[model samples]
Target: MQSIEKYPHYFNSIKEVHENIQSIIPEIAGAYKNKYNLSFPVDINLIVGGFGSNAYTYRQIIPNITFALEKLSPNPDHLRVIVAHEFGHLAQYIMLDDAGMDWSKSRWTHPLIWLYREGIATHLSRQIADNIHPSVYFSYNDEGVQWLTFAQANMIRIKQAFMEDFKALTSEKLFHEWFSINGGNRFGYSRLAYFLGNRFVLEYMEKHGEQATIIAWREENFEAKIAQWLSQEGVDKSE
Candidate 1:
């Protein structure tokens, strides 16, 4: 309420966002369907104010994507990447559910789980969206200039700190420092974990192949494998 009141222009593009987002949803979803040969019903909902994310996926008997128009970038390329990223999440969840993944037992609280989730989605966004500037795939907008530069330069340091946090920090602290928008105490940039996740997906795909890496969530030793990957040195150099 306060944000809307003070920064009315923040949501001034709501109408435009609504039109463009509705127009692109099917196109991007179709590309994903064709790429993976997996088609599933998805409900795309647009809202004025959401949980502060530009977009996210939620499943309640069916998969749905919610776009907070105010948080979104109206640039067509950014919209495609963001939408495709959310659908990438849908593809991941559907694959796991089809494999009989017990949602109750899944390690939802683990940071590495999130790393894989965001990593694969970011990877899929890069593939699904038409050729755009590379940083758009990660940050989904032009505003990511600083974030991209920092992530590229400090990849190894970030991984080391992330691994240390995995062993030392609680889930809440880990997420805040790495994943949340308000994070970045160490590196002065939030959501650096997305960069980490992308690297994980890339390396894992190189080692195990794309199909296996996509469904690695179902593997019995997922945690151990991710831990081992994290413990290794110079994984950044591979990229």
Candidate 2:
């Protein structure tokens, strides 16, 4: 574990946020494990930016660790939800490589990674709340909703592409270029992927059973995986 100095004397509120986050970790992890059958005491990947900024990350590294995390919240209830959303990231990251596309430096690399990453993380942040809890959001930005909607529309298409009808994107340069060109829309791409990916996963489980979905999530043919998604949805490729 590494320790970074706190943002010295910024908004001072950052410390409170930090303390709040640490306090809630254990309870959050417990809920995730119980609900999802995930491993407990999960690793946390937290990045707190100077006033008015935050980012979350998780790795697809092996040995399967899903740190069920809720995000930063001053309120106790919101904090727990944030932690769970982060846990969602951990779950997605563990399954990333199995989807078979390498991570691209491009902002656009998100789609290649797997449908779970972008949408779920944001979904956790924005949606995924108990009836009593406050919703998470991207700085109360309406554009955020638009981006999410965009992703939701295209998700089915992207997942199908992941399963099939896809080219192995090996060019790092191309990846970076496309990502840079797309910029924030890359986020939208991720959202779209998640929207579709989770549905596919849900249906897959219903049809194949939990164990099969977990195993096939790791080994199914990329094209075959996509066929089901693409058949049902037409992506709004505008942008």
Candidate 3:
């Protein structure tokens, strides 16, 4: 429920981001409460540096939500989407806790599970964005447009290559290769899992309703459902 901003020395002059985060926090909190029935009072820290475009959520010892402002797009709408996305992770943490699921145990090590996590968060974020401003759901200027476009264009080839190689790889190796920018076989894009995860979520939402999708996050059989859905949808095969 508390929003904190930690600016790097280089970002001392930035003042607008504070106002921006302040404006979006209530909206995100409201959406989480309405959609997931969870009151998220977690401390959200916006910092200056991180790895990817999305805000990072740490759930190990404590629930920490950190957003790397430098990594996010400067567009205000885009920033709102990022906040919703990270808050979706916060919602997941609460749901997982209530369900008695220990994410750090062994499930965190699985790449596909990570894909589902990211995908579900992406879906919820889009839902929140749509509720706030429908236009921003998939804005042309959004970075996700480029990633989704590239993924769709190359899905056939990417899926083909993935199935061929996936059988021979370990979970850790597969996770890194699919997610790393320097892996050198990403079909000219990194974070292939994000795109795949998004598609998986879309398929699930289309078949089931949004409520079902939201409830699946806390289900013990969520991973099994993901595997079954992938097989049923033939994710590894050409359409």
Candidate 4:
């Protein structure tokens, strides 16, 4: 009701987003299934007027995915990238579950865990939905040039700032600063940690190979390793 009242002008655009999602999700799901060589059925739910999340994975009871149409763009490329991104999450969960990962032991509350999860999902989205403009993977819109450029130019400073927060032991504010849409006080860009996470995943893949990087959180020192990456102590700063 509030969303309907707040932005009545966007209702038509939201409807178009719904239509685009319906048309494209099957193809996106098929691509991910083939790329990962997995046969699980994809369950997608369309929604509106929620908490402004573009899309999210619901892992309780069953592996279900939902997209908030009002929070998404009507562009087909955006739909493909976001849909594949959610499914990327599903793939990560299923792979770990099938491998007998102990859910009770997982560090579900840590910032590092969040970083790795989003990073791997973002990375997988680009791979499944290949050869589009790079900004789509991060921004979900064609107008994300500024966001990407800012993040790329300030990699060292961002990583160092994150490293400081990681060592502070105050995770609630840290998580919001890095991951939430409402945060930008640090660098004036929300979800900058998503970019940082993707960079960590890319480097980890280069060093440790694919499967290991996907399940890197399983190791006990996962957060420590992520902190080390954020420290960037001796690493090259000019990229």
Instruction: Name the TM-score of candidate 2.
Output: 0.52
User: What TM-score goes with each of the models?
Assistant: 0.92, 0.52, 0.73, 0.91
- lDDT string, candidate 4, 1-239, tens digits: 77657667788898899888887888977886788875557567888755477888764423788888888989898888988888888888777776767777788777888898899999889988888888889888897788888888788888888877778747888888888888878888888889888989989899998788887777776888887788764443222
Ranking by TM-score: 1, 4, 3, 2
Backbone clashes for every candidate come to 0, 17, 2, 0
- Predicted structure with the largest TM-score when compared to the true one: 1
Per-residue lDDT of candidate 1, residues 74-149 (tens digit): 8888999998898888888877777777677678667898998899999888889968887888778898887888
Which of the two, 1 or 2, has more lDDT? 1
lDDT of each: 0.82, 0.44, 0.62, 0.81
lDDT of 4: 0.81
Q: Superposing every Cα of model 4 onto the true structure, what RMSD results? A: 2.2
For residues 1-239, write the lDDT of model 2, one tens digit per residue: 12233345333545565667676676655655565555533456445543322334433343232221221445655665556556656644444544553544312233433443333443433333344322133222123456545555655545444444235544443233222223223343422334454455555556876444544534434434545454665434321
| Runs in model 4 lying further than 4 Å from the true structure | 59-62, 234-239
What does the lDDT read for residue 136 in candidate 1? 87
For candidate 3, the lDDT comes to 0.62
TM-score, prediction 3: 0.73
Better of 1 and 3 by TM-score: 1
Model 2, runs deviating above 4 Å: 1-13, 45-78, 89-113, 116-182, 185-191, 209-211, 234-239
